[model samples]
Structures are given as C-alpha cells and as structure tokens.
Target: MLPDISVVLTTYNQGKFIKKAIDSILSQSFNNFELIIVDDGSIDDTKRKIDQYSDSRIKKVFKQNEGPSSASNVGISLAKGAWIALMSGDDISLPDRLQVQYEFANSFNYKICFGLPIIIDDEDNIIPDEDFPVFFSDHSFSNRKVFKRLFEKGNYFCAPTAFFQKDIIEEKNPFLISSLQLQDFACWLSLSKKYDMPIINKRLIKYRRHANNISSKNNNGRMEFEMKMIYKNILNNMTWELLHEIFPNQFSVASMNDKRCFEIEKSFLLLKQSIKSVHEVGCEKIWNYINDDVMCSILSTKYNFNYLDFFMETGKFNTNERDESND
Candidate 1:
C-alpha cells in the first residue's frame, strides 16, 4: 500500500548534514510516510552516506548534476502518496513536524500549508536572535487577494516547511525549471495565485544557515535579476489589458526599467490595500518588507534614479515617522 505522505529531499555535496536530515525523517512521529532522497550528482561521499541508510521506506535516486529544481521534479514524479512534503538535506525536521502539518492540512481541507522554522547554525545550534526581519512572517494567507499581494512583495515562507497535497503538483507542476536558485519561491508564488496557503504557527523545521547553502552563494546582482524575472513572468501571464488597468502610469512609462520600478511600487500599494482590507493589525509588518531599501535601491539603479529621493518625495518615510511619533 502507498504511504500517506511522500517526503522529497534533494541533496548535492551535503554529505556532512545528509545523515542528520535522513535520520530526522526516519525518526518522525508520523510513520506512514515514504522518504525519497535524490542525490544530484554529488562528488563528495554523499552516496556512501545514503547507502548506510537501509530504511525500507527510503527510496534513493541518483542523477546528474542538473540542480535542485530538476532533482525535486524527479522526486515529485516518483511520489505516490496522497501528500508531498519538501525537505532539504541540511535542515532538520522536528519529530512532530509532518504529523502536525498533515493533520492541519486535512482538518482544514487546505491544499497547501507551511510552518515557521527555527533558524540554526552549521553546528545545529539555534540562533539566539533569529527574529531578523523578513517579507512575510507568522501570518496566514487564506485568500487569493492577500496571498497575491504578499507574494508580490517577496517570498516569506520556508520551502523546507512546505506540506501539501500531491494533486496540486501533479495537476499544475508549479515548480519552474528556469528558477534554478529559487524554485521553491517560484512554486509558492504560482500556487498562492490559485490556492490558499495557510500557516501552521508552530516551528516545524530547524533551518540551517551555512556557507555552502545555495542562497548564501548568490551575489546581490544575480538575486535581484532573478527576482525581477520572477515578477515579470507573473505579470506577463496576466492579460496585458488587465495589467494596464491595474497599473496605468507604469504601463505608460517609456523605459522598461522605469516601468519595472513603477510596477513594483504599484505592487507595494496593492499589498497595503489588501492587508488593510483583510487584517486590522500587522499592516506595519508588511510595510517593512515593501519599503526595504535594498530592494528599492536595486530598482532605482536599474531605472537610473535615486530611490531614496523617490521615497522622500513620495513621503513614504515621513508618513511612517509621523505615525510612529503620534504613537
């Protein structure tokens, strides 16, 4: 009989941490799950480490070094369970993580769900002040309007914490092969456009931050470029007429760079509007990500202007200061 959940873990040269990752799953409180490990052409002793595992439920697939997206796609194709759980070789899932997420998904009839993760160092020690600012956090998106707005700002969910029904992937194949370094973010964005992504408040995974992590290797320019492409792709899929209707001034801009900045600003406004419409609190939290300087700077440089000046002229900073002063 097929398992209730299929856990897909993709590893490349993560030999040191791979064993811990696998052991975490094998020791999960949830027993009715199959663990699928895809080794993406690791030149290290990753294969030897995997070979040491003889769990009957563990399925190992060895493949060429294509990247995480391709490896995950292969695992998705092999999944036979009713639900699929995403994992990374360097992360540790709490024993109750799968059980909690699985129950939450079924109990609420949610197609996709994710939980918060505790940040850990290379030594598996929890970071004392892991409360660093992020785009989205601790809140759940139960509607398309709010989800789209949140996604437009940035990816807020931990990929390794994602737990969802298998049919969602089999039907849509939301993971994009082109999103080499950001397949999980792209996938979440695509799915959030159509489904509600509720969050389980508990921290289910120990997210390891290490030097060898894929995100750690990305330069600022490449990260910004990839993000721009993701946003552009999402916008392009919408009807041109609709996009113009939503962002008339942005569409009227002559320069492509200027247009991108305008669109980003428009997204920021829409996100605020959506938040105000749905939740009374946490609007300020959303703004933190929307008004991020690094993102604004990237857009400004691409569009040939001082984004700081734009912020000042638009009274974005002054308004926030005024609000805080009043408080």
Candidate 2:
C-alpha cells in the first residue's frame, strides 16, 4: 500500500538549500509520506547532496535539463500517495505544515489546498516586505468566487505552499509545458476553473527570496508573456455560465440566459479591468469574435456595443494612470 501523502520536491541547482528543504519534509509532524525529489539537471552539488539522504521514505529521480513545467510533470508522474504536496527546492516547509494542510484538506473534503507564506532571504532571515502571499480570509471560497479572484487580483496563491490530491494531477495533467516559468499560476487557473481549493489561514512555508528563484517576476519578460497567454486561453475557453457567475450583474438577466451573448459580454468587463495585459487581450478577443458577420449581429442585437461603438470604447480605454505608450 502507498503512504498517506507523497511530497514531490522539484529542485534544480538549489544544492545549498536542498538539504534543509528535504530535512523539513523528513521531519514533518506528519511522517506517513514519501518524498520524491526530482533533480532537474542541476550542475551544482544537488545530486551529491541528495545522495547523503538514506531515509527509506526518500526517493530520487535525476534527469536532464528541462524547464520547470517538465520537471514537475516528471515528479507528478511518480507520486504514489493519495495526496501530493509540492515543495520548491529552495524553500523550507515548517514542521507542522504538512499536518495542518493535510488535516485541513481532509476535514473539509477539498481536493486542492494552499497555505500562507512568509518571505525569507539568502541567510534564512524573515524579510519584511509586501511581496509575500496573503489569502486575506479564514474561510473557503466557491470555485466561481476563486476563479473571479484569480482574474481580478492576479495570483495570490504562492506555488510553494501548494498541496492537492493525486487524483487531480492525474485527471487534469495541469502545469502546461508552454507556460514557461508560470506553470503554477496557469495550473491554479485551470484547476480553480473546475475545482474549489482552500486557502488555510496558517503560515506554513518560508518562501526564499533570491536572484535565482524561477518563480521570480523578474524573469526576462517571460512572466508577462506567459501570464497574457494564460489569461487569453482561459477567456477563449470560458463557458457563459462561468462568465455570468464571475460578473453577476454586469450582463443583463436576458443576456445571462443566452450563452453566446453572456460569453461575448465578458470582453466588455475584461476591457474595463485595471490590468494592462488582461484588458489588451480582452480587446483582442472581442475583435476576433466580432469579425464574423453572424457573431457581430448576435453581439450587436444582444448587447449595445457594435463595431464602431466598441472601437470608440477601446480608443478611450486606459488601464494605467500614465498612458505613455503611443500604440
């Protein structure tokens, strides 16, 4: 029989911190778990450091240099527990972290779970900054509420604090390889679209802050590009029921009753949001949908915006306080 949980710790060249990360899980208050460490082509001493561990609960997979999404997928494929907890190579999980999250998810019957995080530095000192993840609530949210929050506020759920059922990983096969460094955010968006994950009100992980962190937004414009792609993908695939649920009163009740109309009406609200890339993508999507005469007629009849009206609104749109771009 398998362990109660499988901890898939995906590490690259985090040799310096990898031992502490592994030790954190090995010393978890909840010990009925297997730790699978996937070394994603670490050029440093990550492999040699991992070799120091002799714990039977610890398993290892050494592989070539693949991006984060690919490395994580490899680890997910090897998970043997009923539940899976994802830990980054550079961060440290508190001893009670597993116990608290596992119990919380099990008690509430939530398939996916996330915990709060406190940022740490290279010296393992707690850093006081506004960049850390905060869930802002003690209660759980419905899938729709969570989905809407994901779109409006961006990613508040930090990947290091992530925990979920093994079944979800199997069924969804999330963490798109095309998502680049933002696999977690994209996966969260995809999962939250269908499943309700809870944010436990406890601080569980010490998310390390350093120049080498892949989850860093400082990545060479890849973060922004991936985020745009993720948002566009979600909008393109959204059902009207979800769109209507996200924007309750934005669409008239009659429009809500009509799937196509309600779906098209989402572009209007997306265009009004304060996020630049999101609204830009929304504008692009509307233009794409309106090019066909039949869809144009449907949108024109169902909603007030026609081609010229939409053009005027798009022209007047400004997401930022300072509109410096000439485009």
Top model by TM-score, which number? Answer: 2
Clashes (N, CA, C under 3 Å) per candidate: 0, 0
lDDT of each: 0.69, 0.78
TM-scores of all models? 0.72, 0.87
Model 1 clash count equals: 0
True lDDT of residue 178, candidate 2: 76
Over 1-327, each residue of candidate 1 has an lDDT whose tens digit, in order, gives 899999999999999899999999999999999999999999999999999988899999999998888888899899989999999998999999999998999988899888888888888887753343352344656545434545444567778998988887744346776666556776776777568887788889998877454333244334444554565455435543444554455454433345445454444434343222111122332344347886556545554445354443344332222110000
- What stretches of model 1 exceed 4 Å from their correct place? 129-131, 135-138, 170-173, 212-218, 237-327
Q: Pairing residues by index, what is the TM-score of model 2? A: 0.87
lDDT of 2 by residue, 1-327 (tens): 689988989998999999999999998999799999999999999999999999999999999987777788888888889888999899999999999988999898899889887778989988764544244433346878887777776666868888998887644356887766567877887788778977887889998878465344345356656666877767666766677677777666776577666667677777776666667777887887789787788877767678897786567655432221101
Q: What lDDT score goes with residue 43 in model 2?
A: 98
RMSD of each: 10.2, 3.8
